[model samples]
Target chain A: MNHPWTGPRLARVALLLAVAVFGPAAGPRSGFETMSPELRAMQQDDLANPGMLHVAEGEAQFQQQGCTACHSAEAMQGVAARYPAFDAARDGPIDLAGRIAQCREERQGRAPLPREGKEMLALSVFVAHQSRGLPLTPNPDPRMEFVRRQGEALFRERRGQLNLSCGQCHDDNAGRRLAGSLIPEGHANGYPLYRLEWQGLGSLQRRLRNCMVGVRSEPFAPGAAEYIALEAFLAERARGLVVETPAVRP
Target chain B: MARTLLRVPGTAQRGEVVEIRTLIQHPMETGFRPGADGTVQPRDIIRRFTCLYNNRPVFEADLHPAIAANPYLTFTFVARESGVLAFIWEGDNGFSQTETRALTVA
Candidate 1:
């Protein structure tokens, strides 16, 4: 594979695996067109009849739950294009789910959503589904400098009882699969997705929170700053990755 | 069938530069969905869509597989004149639908 970068774009897959691959210059084209050997071997068990039911449920939750009353699906047009956006107003970064929570409390005058709660997940999926295929646009506004810097650190810092950084897997072992799932070049393109493990729609923060739990890392509050920091980093990394929010992932 | 949902603020007035947003309901099949035998499903997607003003075309798109289910699109256009804003879509499975809404300009 041709790589214009300084080194291989992807490192070895596993702790002991010795396969090497390269290239971010041709990354996007290859990512969607050709499946990595690891991904090609994946089973097609989850692909089946249409599953619009979850989307419908999410739509209902979005309306009946009073989410649309504040966050304008219209005013917020192309909002998903810019995310992990540094909110100068809040003096921090706001992720997709975090924005939802902010509206729940600030505008709707309700309690903050539970990070892993059903309504929160459903709402996140519905909102994220609103924007798909739009190129990710990470805003590196100066006000977001602090949060973005923090996020980069979080990405590089080793954590979990495993003491592995996110970079180890996403940056280091992109295109490799762990267990059955391919190690996607970690990006924030697909925010809310129907994960096979969850068997339902969930947001990126939910996935991050799950990973934190798995690593035995002290979990942040649902809309914690640290998670937003990580979101900012991933959003920046995925600058060109299309926004496939509310995607179905197995 | 893709459901086209449109939203305009109450403040919208005639001759105003308005943001036109559309959300169409369709499976947006990536062709990855499986059949009983477990073979790669042929790609079936909403290949194209168009926006018309007073029977004249204003905007159109040729879509790809990566777009999500029930895809949403938005663009802004001037409304100096009022007419029926009609949306038509064509998909791989021979699916087609047209939606129209009235617009008033002063």
Candidate 2:
């Protein structure tokens, strides 16, 4: 039988030891960099990435639904950057998905699609895709202080059978592996992304729900204000990072 | 609802090897897994995909249950003349979708 510590394994051990002793050679990288080359290529290719499909569909809906009569796609540029903003009408923080739902109801004079429905998700993806490369710049508002504080508490509070909070993995153990995948810093810069696990484009709330389920916690409903607050905190934390809308994650 | 997306070059030089890509929203269920109630879910998957240039076949694939949901494919073909590229997907439950794109060759 081959020796367990010989060759590449030994080299890997040596590399890990060096890293442990000397610390990492460089600053943190987006979880994007940790992906396979093929997945990276897919994220870079507009045509090959499946997430683009949803964005394209959203573009169609934007025009057909009469949004273009009021605003051009260019006008929506950088609009997503200010999402998870305070909405006085809702009396709470609202994410891009929530904002889109409100607009559909009030402006389009139509019943709003479910926040997580395909059409709404696609429309939000399409709108956010226009803001690609912009920074996560959620506008500051004094009214949102309470929500932001709540979000911080939730992020830090231990929950579920695992008794782990978002900070435990994303803040402390980031870059480490829990299962087969590396735990990212959990930035909200790239959202309405296509996750290979879901095999479809999903909102950040969907991802958050998945995280809750992973920890055996009861997930909040799709449109619950809790997710919006969490999103607000994440957006604030990820401020200045360029948006990677329609991001592909495995 | 099943939605399809195609990526074809809007403009290309004559005889260039243009890359065309396609993706479709599908579950591609394998019938192997149990549902929330512990009963086996039925199998449903897209089985065939075809791309036609100027009404002539250029690329095709026969997908299996093992394929992931939202099947994505990329293929290359010679840009001979300005024409239309038609993409077709056929699968279980009598599901089929066709989308077309225009190509300009100089």
Best by TM-score: 2
Task: Name the regions of candidate 2 deviating beyond 4 angstroms.
Answer: A1-29, A107-109, B9-18, B35-39, B53-56, B77-85, B100-106
lDDT of 1 at B33: 68
DockQ-based CAPRI category assigned to the predicted complex of candidate 2: medium
TM-score per candidate: 0.56, 0.83
Candidate 1 off by > 4 Å: A1-22, A25-51, A68-72, A179-181, A213-216, B1-106
lDDT of 2 by residue, A23-139 (tens): 754233355656789997888777677888888789988988888888899998898988878888867787888788788898778987877888888889999988887767777
Error of 1 at A63 (Å): 2.5
Error of 2 at A97 (Å): 1.5
Clashing pairs in 2: none
Candidate 2 interface RMSD, angstroms, 1 decimal: 1.7
